[model samples]
Target: MSEKKYSEKHEWVELNGDIATVGITKHATEQLGDIVFTEVPEKGKSFEAGGEAAVVESVKAASDVYSPIAGEVTESNDAIVGDPSLVNQDPEGNGWFFKIKVSDVNQISNLMNKSDYDKFVTESA
Candidate 1:
């Protein structure tokens, strides 16, 4: 287990060595209302930090989910695509969108830790 890192875009990333599992934060799901659909990046796809990594549709809006670090996507959560509500029910667990083989592990250091992210969210709200 590892501490999750966060992005200003409201994505959460759990890093284990060079691999990172990513998903939108619970606050993001709450803001989206009810997630109705999801489009995870395909395996083998590559993206930069802050890139549009996926699409999540909610009753209120369709939002682009951003990557917190640059990497080649290694896996995507088919479970979330099949049952979008999982995003709202367990955004941090089974709802994780994708996993990546990070190209630059140092990029993660630029992101906020849990406490910083919590404060950032609070200050923004």
Candidate 2:
């Protein structure tokens, strides 16, 4: 089974077994405007929770996409790199940045669920 979680910085992580797919939230894309570029981490690259894992740039600004949990990157979505606008078009689906072999599933518990993330976005705005 897959469970999705969100970070305070607006990254989303969906865990299915040891692999966790990570992406910026839709709210993040909305804030970023039209995304023009993306740089995904190379396969085998390791990151600690909260470590900067990728780069996403929009017409308005460039942002770092952080890892929500410690892991080694197993795959990256080249589709988003080839067509950056895919992030704005589908931030949670095809826009996913990478998949990692999660080092500690416990870290996922620290992130928010959908309802909590929605509330956080609302209260922060």
Candidate 3:
């Protein structure tokens, strides 16, 4: 299994070769509260880094989910959309949003590692 990487915007990515799995972090889900709806990009759709690729709506608010690295969308987690609460229940695992065929692997260098993300979450508290 690949380790998780994080974006300052609160997204996370798990890279496994050229494919990357994406999701919102625990902090993000907690901030969003009870999730109600999720909009996932169609499989095979392409997007650039930092582009808006999905939308996640919670009881607290609706937020755009951005692409951490440019890539072609390979798969999406339909289970999470059908039951959005899974995002809050398991933000880092089964609650993953989508998978992407990485267009630029180097873009991941800009994201945070686990320790960095932990520090970020701590400092923001």
List lDDT for all candidates, in order.
0.95, 0.96, 0.93
- Per-residue C-alpha lDDT of model 3 across residues 6-71, encoded as one tens digit per residue: 998899999999999999999999889999999999999999888999999998788999999899
Identify the leading candidate in terms of TM-score: 2
Model 3: lDDT of residue 23: 95
Model 2 misplaced regions, further than 4 Å: none
Quickly count the clashes in candidate 3. 0
Residue 18 CA displacement from its true place in model 3, Å: 0.2
Work out the TM-score per prediction. 0.97, 0.98, 0.95
Name the lDDT of candidate 3.
0.93
Segments of candidate 3 deviating more than 4 angstroms: none
Ranking by lDDT, best first? Answer: 2, 1, 3
The Cα error of candidate 3 at residue 118, in Å, is 1.6
**Model 1 per-residue lDDT at 70:** 95
